[model samples]
Target chain A: MLFFEGSEKKIEVVLQPGQPSLRQLEREYWQQVVAKANATILSSVHNEECDAYLLSESSLFVWEDRFLMLTCGTTTLMDAVVSFLEQFPADSLAMLSYQRKNEYQSHLQKSSFEQDVTALQQQIEGVGYQLGYLDGHHNYIYHLDRPYQPREDDATLELLMYHINGDTAQYLRSDNQTLEGIRQRLNWEALLPGFLLDDFLFEPFGYSMNAIKGDRYATMHITPQENSSYVSFETNLEGEAAALVLNALLKTLQPDSYDLISFNQQLQLDHQPGIICVDQATQPLSCGYTMRFSHYLKPPSAERSADRLSL
Target chain B: MLFFEGSEKKIEVVLQPGQPSLRQLEREYWQQVVAKANATILSSVHNEECDAYLLSESSLFVWEDRFLMLTCGTTTLMDAVVSFLEQFPADSLAMLSYQRKNEYQSHLQKSSFEQDVTALQQQIEGVGYQLGYLDGHHNYIYHLDRPYQPREDDATLELLMYHINGDTAQYLRSDNQTLEGIRQRLNWEALLPGFLLDDFLFEPFGYSMNAIKGDRYATMHITPQENSSYVSFETNLEGEAAALVLNALLKTLQPDSYDLISFNQQLQLDHQPGIICVDQATQPLSCGYTMRFSHYLKPPSAERSADRLSL
Candidate 1:
């Protein structure tokens, strides 16, 4: 169960005309939430408005009255949301999506479904949708009406997750030399021209990552564990998806297989023949947010053959 | 609205101990079913036992009474299935999967579900699944429990499809000289190495392809129609998962994003961190068949911005 959660949750609190400093609210929330907040400023604006912090698991973002937090692994995220809301009024908006691997235990199943549901539902009248296939659940998405949902047609969020298998995953898990090879393959500074990145590798399990980019941050988290390794390329900004960046990421990740999710304000995929995209649901959720989950698949038996060969 | 239908409908008619030749049955079915049937032999050992045929928007296969047929576009498939069952006794197996873009109309909506269901139910006992999202429907998969499902653990089949965008599509669509450039980029004869490939391009809206490497094919179908084009790479061989082909396909297809589905006789993905595979359902369908799907997506907003910039 080496699956890492890629789901996201946002908390948007509207402070009255001249309410308490957002900086004060953001600071208090982090100090109370993150266990080891060896917070390093990756990059940010002058007033720390569009700021990003790399914590134990992933990140914390603070921009004006809006604070967006995302963390994977077994991080105590829901409680952090509940705690921070004590200062803000019940009118605050929230959009939470917590997704993990088929093998990983869900935070929702950890007896927090009703509790967190109560917490967010108590604040805004929005509900949550538990999405996944019959074999196992993929993630949980929760969003409120007003401030949390995108008002503009341009603001779109897309996350691409890759599960590297065969030689690519094996090479990365070989040793330090492989890590160096991957690092050289990336050449991040040259490939991702403008952004300042913070890079590191996790011990024992060999998880290599870069919690990066300028104020409008993007990240590359690679769990380079043998047989169970994964690489995730995520960005919230429109421009982060430059041509070179996309090419460089694909070459580096070299996953045996992958899946795509498009959370657009209202955009739908242009038509293409010969390529089959299995759409999960393109309609808006009960709460008015819309997203499309489409996938191209490798025939199912390949994994079993690989397993037999491995044994 | 660019989507392709890769779903397949395999009609397996089990004959008696001394029934008519499966070859004759296969040919009779084809001439009466698929139009024109511009038959070309890719590969097979001695007899046309394990063969693959390309029709006008459809394909036919005959492997010792385990006949499998697949069709995309506005194909009269179910009617074809019904006509052939006349000569043979009951107890046939059917596995049908035909899916398209969100904007494309579902063949099922045209009142074909009951016709096909009745056609199959008239002979054998099986069911179907309507898989896709709100923007458009995708595929229809059907199968029977007794004869078609593999008892051997080694059996597996997989297909990889990509909705290619960016320069790859542009270069291929530019002109004949650019087609030469793309051909050089592909270097199929050199890259594919083994069997001879049959390559061709369609008129009006260009469709370039290569179907090679014996009966176990490695086909590349490129519909280079700007903003509405796709490139599909499909293979069923176990060793085809080799890294070279994967790299070559990515380099040639150069898709902005893509997804994959692996259909296994009994394969479940090895666990990975961070990646959450939304299982449609883990338990074997009533037919005792199983498959796994994975994806790699570009965040949605980027596409919109790209669309706007193009404007």
Candidate 2:
């Protein structure tokens, strides 16, 4: 199978006062935005708080005052962002932040961080900051400097995982795997509790899901092929809820390493057993948000040595 | 320019008794070995202790009891190892090791580590190991077991750097760059001291060099493109001297991150001022060698924040 870039490009925008609720916007409008990014809306779900899209490449979520859209593969997310801006009055934009995670195969990307920044600058001026090392797990962020208010409860945690292992991973690659099978294996009832979930399984391989409850949301995208296997879990859940889900999923997937990015100090991950935080950085953005990036790695097991002997 | 896989595939084999010193093997014999790996020999140099060849893709070094050959790009170094084994009796193999660094573009590689291990298994039984996280900076090693003697003084250090920056990186990419200029830029006088150096500059932009002193050897290869830029410094030198060279090169190249692998505990690096060791592991290999792998990252600087603002 051809390698897929599971790392995503994300944009979150908070609208100014008097603007229509983003959830009121028609699905056709959102579909155009997704199309501009060169992706499609496979399906979607909504609750009182948000409209969540299960995208062909990744996902999108919309709230009354804000909206988030993320796409993977070689989709031109900057193009989508630019097209999105054209639909709204420039004065209606209270805040705009664009982010991209460093890819395992950056050469396959359609645009570099610099190129994206250049594209974003054409519509709105923003400062770009890089968190962590350029050679390793890092994030590129461009934040537009519009007036904005920070919500006490506004927070987001994104966990991007790589090289997943174990029976769960094997099952993910198996022909018999199903969305319900994965939900059972992951035990979403315990991990996500009351949150509602919407998910899809792709032909040959791959999976994507969106879950919503009140104003809280959680989404997951899994690319389980060997060599380039990856899984990303993201949530707007706060504190212990976020950490609990993080631990539970990690226990199930057992990725060799993962990069965690938190916005607004929502997640304070306590030390995880068997996993060590390898690299971390906290940067306050010009866009009025504090961002923290941490990379965690599981210790190489002694069993790997024994397994190598059998090989 | 297309991205080059700067990470290397390496093999080192020790010969049994009554065998010809690898250094005494004719240049044509080494040429065939390089050819088998699908790389061309660019130049060569020798000292009393070793013979080193600068290849189109990387470098090779030959010593009396053992020889180390490393080639980058998509070259299949395992094929060379298999061919080299044919020239000698199976009993003449004292020990063998084949290693591959996790590549930025693994899908572009001719073979996976598993495939290479399978190929090697056709010749000899060897224990395979994965050092460090498979998703991050890591190494795969397959070591063939045979009668072997471990020497207290036998040690090797390899520093693989990525995403290098600063004037040195720019100069290396510039048309004005020359071998002598790089020598002065890196300050080999302080780094290698008594070592005799031989080097070459590739067309467009790239570099390869070899250095030797008595029974010790060092080799360097540079791929100085933007997205996939990489440089590797390796030496059989011991202790503090090795650390000194490592620090000096880091100062000049200013790579954002680097992976250091030491075999037989040849180097004990003290704390570096601006860099942090993000990951570290020590493994005792079945091939009578202890290997230590450490990944270091320079902290994101305040200056980077300011630089982003200017952009």
Candidate 3:
């Protein structure tokens, strides 16, 4: 037997010699205390581990399986396994360490295996096959049924000359060796319809027209006396298409005029002289009988102010 | 009479009205033909009433002498005369024609003749005065001594400033305001003296120096062991004079190892162990050495290959 003293009173307590005390028994106790404590600790640790797993699961899914195997040498694998064990409860220390070692080994084997599979899949597809699939399945198709046709043979050349002028035909055919080659050479300026200058349609009588082969329209050399001449249309088009289009275009563009006398009379007026008349009943004519006889003058205001000579 | 027959050797002569016969003889022929023909046509025209001299002499001179009783005008006198002529040369001709008629009646007596004589003489002398003459004497003195002494009050702002700066008394009184103002306002980066920093002088120890304004130099926070410091000359006159006159100035600039340590200590170097030297022999001895070491060690070569690392 052994005797123990209390702190507040000198009370004696008896115990078996060499036996464990009640305080030591609390530490050694394994019935419900040890198990309950372990369960609480493990549940909290497991919850934390679950939270970390949810947070990083997508990242792990993307790279963990492949990257882990790449860095899995002896020391690196050991470090991963140890980190895995540290996330488990201390109560389940043995089982968690064993499970972590197995997981590390499995990751290494799976990463190595996937590399071989990926290479095999690439070989099976081959180059250019995917590109052909994309082109056939998903591109637009443009079909030009009436392709541009050009004349290379003598007969075709003759037909072209019959439609266009001889000069135009000569220009088109001089550079091209084949019918397709001549067709490719058709420029925007050379493609105008032949009806533009056809004499039977738009005959230039009072007015004159000059035809130029290239892009720009020919210039006209109309004198001030010939200003009464105008562009006339003979088309069968209707409504605004006939008058509005022609008038609007005429308003913007000017008919070119040059001095024919300066050009040594190479250009000439095709029409008769433009005439202007004055009546005898005007203010100046009423002042004198002699003014009434002056109506036949070529220039009416010749005797008036010098400024009046402009007209 | 002389006569000749058709069948025989005979001759006949008949007189005609306007014929030169021997009866219209020697004295009359010499007077009409020889003497008149011998006279020069120019001298005969000069003797005539309608002489070329009537047109050649300026009508202006004739009118002034006959009507105004004045001599030819001077340059100032001509100004008003020319202005009148410019408006009316024909009117001036008419006036001169009237004057010519008056000159023919020069003997006419007049009551105001003395007064007219005095006025004409005075006008003539007035004209002579502007022509640089006085009485009968020529005044050699012409333009004033100082033709134009422009007033200082009329000077432009820039010219005033130039005058102020040029005057030594004004410059010293203002302590060279113009130079100081210009230096402060100008963009000195473009105009800074070349080779100035490179030539900063180091004193006795032969250490290198780099001089810069306090505003231009960057503040560097360095550890005590790695302090890199410089001595600054702060006086305005010293700085300006140094910039203007110094040559091979680096010889006077001194930067020692001791200065660097003191600067680093002031920057709290003890807190930054990484910057301090741990090993004696391998440690950098100077600021330049430390800078080179830092540059070499930076970012620690990412490439695994030794050849790429060297690059």
* Best candidate, lDDT: 2
DockQ winner: 2
Residue B52 lDDT in candidate 1: 51
In candidate 3 the C-alpha lDDT for residue B174 amounts to 39
Candidate 3 C-alpha lDDT tens digits along B102-123: 0101122121122222332322
Who is ahead in DockQ, 2 or 3? 2
Query: Top model by TM-score, which number?
Result: 2
In the range B1-311, model 1's lDDT, one tens digit per residue, is 23343333334343444555556554445566555222233322223335555554544555554555545444556666666666554533334332222212232222244345665566655545433221111234454435344444323343343345456566666655344566666776666676445545444444434443434454455655544454555554444343455555655565544435444533333222222232232224554455443433332332121110010
Candidate 1 docking class = incorrect
Chain A, candidate 1, TM-score of: 0.71
Ranking by lDDT: 2, 1, 3
Better of 1 and 2 by lDDT: 2
Candidate 2, what DockQ?
0.16
The runs of at least 3 residues in candidate 2 whose Cα sits more than 4 Å from the true structure, single-residue gaps closed, are A1-134, A138-157, A161-194, A197-210, A214-216, A220-231, A236-258, A262-310, B165-167, B226-228, B303-311
